[model samples]
Target chain A: MTDLTLTPVQTRQSHIGKAVLRWSLYILLGVFALFYLMPLFVMVTTSLKSLEEIRTGDLVALPREVTFEAWRTAWSSACTGIQCEGVRPFFWNSVLIAIPAVTLSTLLGAMNGYVIAQWRFRGANLIFSLMLFGCFIPFQVVLLPMARLLGMMGIAGTIPGLIFVHVIYGLGFTTLFFRNYYVSIPAELTKAAKVDGAGFFRIFWSIFLPLSLPIIVVTVIWQFTQIWNDFLFGVSFSQAGTQPVTVALNNIVNSTTGVKEYNVDMAAAIIAALPTLLVYVVAGKYFIRGLTAGSVKG
Target chain B: MTKWLEEHTPKLVLAPSFVAIMIFVYGFIAWTAWVSFTRSRLLPKYEIEGLIQYERLMASPRWETALNNLFVFGALFIIIAMVLGLLLAILLDQNIRTEGAIRTIYLYPMALSMIVTGTAWKWILNPGLGLEAMIRGWGFESFTFDWLVNPDMAIYTVVIAAIWQSSGFVMALFLAGLRSVDQEIIRAAQVDGIPTWRVYTAIIIPSMAPIFLSAFIVLSHLAIKSFDLVIALTGGGPGYATDLPATYMYAMAFSRGDIGQAASSAMIMMMVVFAIVVPYLYSELRSKDD
Candidate 1:
């Protein structure tokens, strides 16, 4: 490759230059990685420090005395509002919201994908386009009316209300994921099933569903991170008792009146971020695939 | 009956979702538009009025500030993120040994929520408690990095935090785009004795226009709906100096109880989104038809 780019007279100089370029590239990547990892490093060290150490020590220094008290307090006893019960309840609220929301949205997307891909009817493209538009609209556009609609349904400010909102808003991306995945699948399998007297549900249940594991993983991880990290819907729809972890983390970090415990705040931020971070670490390849699949094709 | 059910099963499976989106997504947009034209206060009112809320929105200084901040934040955030992301992608494309570790480190931030990003940056940028103090303690007694508190500079802190969180995801997108470019083209350019950088500049980057557009669309949308980051970091603070439309809308609706203002602000946001998105979608769908 180097010889292809360089003439014989320039070979030695070009080899030296290429080596220089290679090292420079590594240096550039190193600098960027440092910049990217700095905040997480600070958050971890700060969360581990005693409050006294945080107050007195250098911001970048390792904690002189490591402690897990802040994590414990953030999880069990930090006051966000009138309740001093910490983020425990809100964490559960997020779990409740995310589980059903991811499950329902993924299932609905699979079904929608199956129909749109295999059982194409007239106007299916139109319906898919309409749903695609749902992905782009700013959520602010629906806030007031959604609040009103939730009120009318008598589930406003509840965990169920938050779940419904996530599932509804999530349909676009989930459907897009499944539809794109299913479109790549050959149509012959479904057609063959039809000839064997298999109906829509049976063909989908036995064949498409089994074949959908990869896309389903992508969709579930995508939806799980999205719904779990959601703040707008969580903050807008749910109140004190049912607020999700993201909202609670915000309130805990931003609440004014008491002495600001930087350690506790850092711990709470890490706590709020842990689940998604874990998913990314364990399945980052799938996460990247999902992200690229969603954006690159659009 | 069997025949009818067979024919209808797919439609039956699709019906609930289609109806939900028709109402929850499209229907609510219409409702918000209607409410934006009304004189609603703490609660929504159905009575029709004519642009009164918009008139108020235009008159309010806070709304103006939010719009200006959005423009500044959006422009800087998008441009910087794309450039940095492209640079990182180009660097990673050099076939470095530590590419996987570095890529993972860069992309990890995107996995976490904006709220987490905001809080971490908030502490990092805090004048008395964070960077300033740390630098001062290192014997640079006169050093200061206090954008987190300065009213005029607070919005840029949001910009900084946003770029940090998103540039990695942008890199991932661009990296994928870069990798997909045919190796044969580079070989051809190499045979012509073109410099490596020039080959990339002239041939490679130009071919990734679609990826560039996709990144722009995603980043701009995230910027436009930037409520959580602002709320968690600055709370549009130093007297609303950092308010973007998203945070402004939330404040008006949830805190100030001015539902009319919220609705109008939201409509304006939606208009901004539509202006950027609809044209792109039109071109995309049109091209697909051919």
Candidate 2:
């Protein structure tokens, strides 16, 4: 309609107008990109600068003299508390905690989701509804009871205790991801497997699990991010030696007695952030799938 | 035994997770709810006394502040994140050349933990050495970005970092929703000489009601459970001025030795979540039934 109504000169003017609009859109998008990148920029720049330079120089300026001292300290020697061991132990602590928790939760959730979606027992829907509602409750509600229970179970303030808590809370989400995915898979495949006398684990292992590669990736990424980035459980359930990197990072930055080592704090923050950042950058498609597919923790 | 096992295998596999959830999710909620009614302080007292803890919670000024902050923070965080996220999504949808890089930048913050976000913003909002000092360095002597230290404006700073952290994900959500809108409808509307803005308002946005609701649920959920950010950024201070309920409960339970207060606050928080989540779940389940 615009082409039909416009003369030759009018079309050329409209072309220029559209060009301006398009460029302005790009500029607006670029500005937002800058806003989003600002903190990461500040962290990187501040981390690379010396303390003397950080104090005397601009907050967001590129470091005139770049140094890895802050990174070294943050990784190996920054004082998180009375302990000056840095976030290294806590970083390894997170790795240990996240792996078993992620694996166990993904496997358990896959089984639970498989049954609910395909096997459809007499009361499976009821069971699922019970479990599904569990996902949205704020962890604060569960913290006190879980603390006492962990103490009773004699795993309180330990790494295994943290893993146990994550696996338990993570079930609802893991089950959900698998259930929805398996539900999309045609029921006939499972029926044929069952008809051929393939048992429960057999059918799952040979048939469903083979088709489950994509969902497994999604579930693994989702649980890894949630468990890795977890602060509430990490802070509450673990003792000094068992603390995760996020808690350690918090302590390093917020410990009030020292001269505030802004560079070290930024480095520590980045170190804590690097794992999930890598996941988002490398396999962002699956990460986004997990995010949208009811990994409801924010 | 093997034949019997085959019949029960699905239930057998589910039994462990089911029992754990029952114990942790439902059972612990019951335990916490019981504690809220007890006189437990500094430890667990299993005896149910009444609603004394709730009365105490309602009467306390700090709890009042926490509740008020939740209202303010929840509202602003949801509204602004949604608006800004939708704006970003719409802009990114316009056949932009570098959309992936921009989307990745926007969504990367969600990958980082709240503690990281808070740590960065904590420095950026620092009064003496942060954005303020940098701006002052540019020859303006009167710039003050002291919300990190100011009592009244502290909660808003958390809101800022939170919006930065979450709105990108919301953009991703809305962008997905925008892309899923029927292209044919949009094409037809454009052929009718309707403006792009009109097409969005009249057709595209209106079709995103479900995504809008889901985003609201997600953000409000984030707001209610916000603890790490507050702790890292403000530590619920300048005298607990920025205390959200989650932080308030933590203070009462672990730091202040008021387990009863923690329990009661926890119960209230659960109630708030249930209030929001149950209906959302109900509607979602109902729709899935179709």
Candidate 3:
């Protein structure tokens, strides 16, 4: 403030410079935002167009006659095969699978994180390290064996099979999220709870759990997106009847010999992406915060 | 009794996740390793088949193509994402208005599944109905943008889509790092007549090295496991031009009914991942020791 008041010429020069910079920043950011949004913009426009317009390939043009038929078709009437049931049935299955998968995995992950970050039990660190290490292992390395094992358990191709897979993989990051968060939490809180004769579960349930809202939101959003959008596991672990929306979307999009239904494909993708996109828009700040804090402390 | 219960409480807390992960993840991975050496086809069979699967895998042109494609894809995806992410983060740090909306726009793609990403990008890049057609419609008949259909340039098209999808995540990481940097450093650099770009290039970027490495590792893992996008976009098409290792393994196992060969390909991928990850893990683990 003092420096600006003392230098009139410098202040005027600075004002002009600042004005130039502001508009330049706006223009630059506006351009990049379009780049960021191009695919989505194209998809939505195409989805509103008729099949003839899509095949004619004037993708950037405003539709001659915009229609919601593709959305209607993709949601309720498009064929996965001979069924023509669209993707509606699989939406509930996705919801059902996602709910429990998200719940159980997150609860267990929080508990594991609490125990790992707080308790110094023998071999606990080793187990936690191994679990974290598992985060790096790719799914391709486990698909065959998991198939065989799930077959042995008689759980292959079941919803339970998919839930079980989500929980297992979800542990890597969710537990890491909770664990790192718990580390950042002052140990005095836990120590005080223990001094009050609280057991492990009691302390976690009361003291730690209440303070864990941010991480819980993070895990829920992450797991929801992951399990909902998952394809390989959904396709591999489940039979045709039990597959999720991702598989149905794939089948709709990838029926090689049939004419590609660009409109319906775009609509279905928008449908598939809507849930997570909504979650992000509503809670994106905490999402970034959770990731930042979790990464730094972890 | 109290001592025994106290001793076992953490185990109880951890038991459910521990057992679930071991059985599903580690145990299944072990099974994958075992199957690679067997004569299984379309399913797992436990019989000693020596190294025949490995021999078959090595002989397959498709496997080689997938492996090379992963390298090309991985390198480009990481490099491009990092560069773009850092630049975006720096620009956004200029105290720009509408920062929230800008951030949301960048990160929205990360919210979508790769299936959606592939679908959306495929439409955008499709030679018949996408940018090429749109451009041609503008009266430039010679404007050729058919890389999605070209076997040679198909992989780069994948690279572009992937960079768009992932740079936001790297941006978030870099954004966090940039916010943490001391304002004093910027002031000092300005006092010394150092340009803002040079100061960022020389000082700020080096300071964000750890954040960069972590983002790099995460993206690299994603690149290795990239199947959904390939499935959605090209389907490894125009004659398997963009077939990545994970997709190749899926094809071998499910489409070709060669579980043994698939297992071999998966093991090779795991080995590649391990080679990259082990040293990284070692360093991360060692850092805490210091």
Candidate 4:
């Protein structure tokens, strides 16, 4: 009976059927890919079209007269609030906020992770646990108090204030990322460094830091994308002149006073999105690795 | 002194972040909880009252809509993303030639911010300018896809945009989980005259429970904190038809001068997060103990 099941006459027919099924699967995947890429295609084509062409054209049509005018306007001339200087200043604001936030948070997290993973002092687990909870809590829970704190610090509505918030909130994930990576390193490495009379800072600098390239890449990309893409903190903490690119993008697109410049809106959206998109396209493998690692550990 | 320093260096390194989190995370949570019970408005007041803000929050029809929308959006977003993501993962697991390209395409959305996703989707969903117009131009004059403007359907538009952004992420997670499943067991099952589908259903998928749980936790957390997406896409508009608690809290505190309302809403959001995360943490820590 088992032999009959294995050598059934249906095998020949099923082979062809499986081929058809496989092709259908490919087709289905192609359709889904189209769905995923459609908005991007629309954005690109729409951004390329002039206002007149956009009005006359369908969303899916390739631009009849491609122009960089929208791009120019989005970058240099578009009004985001009262400022007609376009998304430039806001773009720089985001850069300012993200660079420092990413650097400080990653450094702090590395130190925390090293201590928790290697040094293992008293109450270390408790500290790690408490920090990890920060990763999961809704930011609303802290927004009011954080606003009050930022105001009290007299840094409210400043880029530095936004950076502080990002760093504080970011500590949890960065710590988790580094701690997980460091946990896999053998304790003997640290012990050897200690035997050679290396202090904590020395061992970390010489032994651990060099070995952390992979995790650091993961950590940097994660932090860069996160802080770059952050909107809530950007909107809440910073106002007009200091607002990040995200807040500017929101303002530019959602502003209701003027003619609805869909083309400029699309272009500005692309500009706001370009950095992280570039990161993903360039280092997608690292991004995926970081994502999976973060999810799995959680 | 050297020995003491050696013993204490780790603690010293950890102390700053420890203190910051204590004040920033736990401390703020406590303060927000305290603020929720007061009658503060416009600015935070320290006068302690009892449940007036909560009572007002529960009374507001907008809050009711926001809570209901949260449940509806959360449930649909989680379920739809999981199903779609799993299906994509299973398809890609067939070892197709285009796996790398397709996976990259799917995962790219996750890299963009909610603002970008919301903006792009807004353009595509705009009634006269987007899908509706395109379909209408394609000789389907009666066809309409105006969920963007319809108040009753606006929240679903948020759901659609969110699933578009996140399903790819969930797919990557599931694909990773699917790849790590032992193949020998599947081959054994196949050799025993079991069908391929049966092997996957009965053996492979059962082992992926932990991934599903993780995905659920991640998606739920995202749903609760869904502020930026709503802001960019709908602005919780058409008369507050799509106010998720995050947006509600923002509107209350920043725009409406209702600090107490914001605090209460924020506390409710935290409670929702705790409801989901606390049990998951308990299980995780207990499992580690085992």
TM-score of each: 0.97, 0.98, 0.94, 0.98
| lDDT of model 1, residue A54 | 88
Model 3 ranges off by over 4 Å: A1-21, A290-297, B1-3, B47-50
- The residue pairs found clashing in candidate 1 are none
| Model 3 residue B118 distance off true place after TM-score fit, in angstroms | 0.6
Expressed between 0 and 1, the share of native interface contacts present in candidate 1 is 0.88
For B1-290, candidate 4 gives per-residue lDDT tens digits of 98998879989899999999999999999999999999899878888999999999999999999999999999999999999999999999997998999999988999999999999999999997788888898899999888888999999999999999999999999998998899898888987889878877999889999999999998998999999999999989878999999999999989998999999999999999999998997788668659
Q: After superposition, how far is residue A235 of candidate 2 from its true place, in Å?
A: 1.0
| Best model number under TM-score | 2
Candidate 1 has an lDDT of 0.91
Residue range with the least summed lDDT across 10 consecutive positions in model 1 chain B? B280-289
Candidate 4 per-residue C-alpha lDDT over A1-298 given as tens digits, one digit per residue, 9 for 90 to 100: 6556645558978898999999999999999999899889999999999999877779899999899999999999999878888898899999999999999999999999999999986688888889988888899989989998899999999989999999999999999999988989999999998999899999999999999998999999999999999999999999788999999999999988889999999999999999999999999999988887776683
What are the chain A TM-scores for all the models, listed individually? 0.95, 0.97, 0.90, 0.96
| Per-candidate DockQ vs. reference | 0.88, 0.82, 0.70, 0.88
Ranking by lDDT: 2, 4, 1, 3
Clashing pairs in 4: none
- Using DockQ as the measure, name the better of candidate 3 and candidate 4: 4
Q: Interface RMSD of the predictions, in order shown?
A: 0.8, 1.1, 1.7, 0.8
Worst 10 residues of 1 chain A by lDDT: A1-10
Clashes of each: 0, 0, 0, 0
